[model samples]
Target: MVSLAPYVLKRPWLTKMLTPAANWYASASGYRQLGLRYDDLLEEENEAVQIALKRLSAKEAYERVYRIRRSVQCSYTHKLLPKDQWTKPEEDVPYLRSILAQVEAELAEKDALDSMTVIKKH
Candidate 1:
């Protein structure tokens, strides 16, 4: 609830004239790097990501989304898909059809996640 400046100022060891001010400013700057306000700075990053159900083009937007997801190890490739094999496993039509079903299921799950993320927040 308290701002960084006052908190830093209260600690004598952390304060020496403008040093506390500078330190607080630097700390706040780091929060800005994380796209946070100083007062809301310590809140979970996931808290903000549940903003809204923005529309997206499938392939290109998907690439961007997965890049960020992979950056955070939250993508299917990071979680479920393996390094050696992705897409339909090397199998006959029935096997491939089952794999396609699983893929569709995964895609639907991802969509449901993205859609429902904002429900509570909204």
Candidate 2:
């Protein structure tokens, strides 16, 4: 999906104005309350995401798995984590996004190369 995120993020005033609404929306989305960072909720079925996940540092991968498992357990129990245990706003940084972007770029570049036509000049 195309997003205005980059555009809005580039403008200081827009970002400042939107930050609270974004935070509220995130909190209201309930994943953080379940102790899952936003990245933890990304769809793993995606090829780019799968590659990005594999590229994560061991510690980050472990932590991501732990968070997912903990969230799953919470889901079974029908309970949210205690407030202190909930993912904090700062802690909800997009750790996977950068890697995912890099993987996507690589895939696009590979596709471009694959589609290239080699023309012999006489």
Candidate 3:
């Protein structure tokens, strides 16, 4: 994946300029109003997501399910969560991203090991 996050983070000026825009975009995306974190928007069909879900603590997993169910209920009712109940910017952390990254790294490492050739040293 070619992410510009690293490049943006490397330049203090760019980070400063984009931070507010990014925050505004995230808020405008409406998931927060549904009380769902950014990580909850990730698709669940992939193996990495499955692994990441499994890696979540019981509380975190339950909370994730609750958010999804609540969001669905809101969708059905055509309503947004009350202001106080909305997911705060600070609360919209990337809970699954770290675990997903770890899973990807492990899969990559496994692939590397599997593709290794044995060299016999006499």
The most accurate candidate by TM-score is 2
After superposition, candidate 2 runs with Cα above 4 Å error: none
Q: Candidate 2 — number of clashing residue pairs?
A: 0
Residue 122, candidate 1: how far off, in angstroms?
A: 12
Better of 1 and 2 by TM-score: 2
**Candidate 1 ranges beyond 4 A from true positions:** 1-93, 119-122
Model 2 is weakest, by summed lDDT over 10 consecutive residues, at: 33-42
Which candidate ranks first by lDDT, i.e. highest? 2
Cα lDDT tens digits, model 3, 22-56, are 99999899999999999998989998889889999
Candidate 2 per-residue lDDT, tens place, 21-47, comes to: 999999999999988999998899999
In angstroms, how far off is 25's CA in candidate 3? 0.5
Q: Sort the predicted structures by TM-score, highest score first.
A: 2, 3, 1
Misplaced by over 4 Å in model 3 are 117-122
Name the better of 1 and 3 by TM-score. 3
Model 1: lDDT of residue 20: 58
TM-score of 3: 0.91
**Each model's C-alpha lDDT?**
0.41, 0.95, 0.94
* TM-score of every candidate: 0.21, 0.94, 0.91
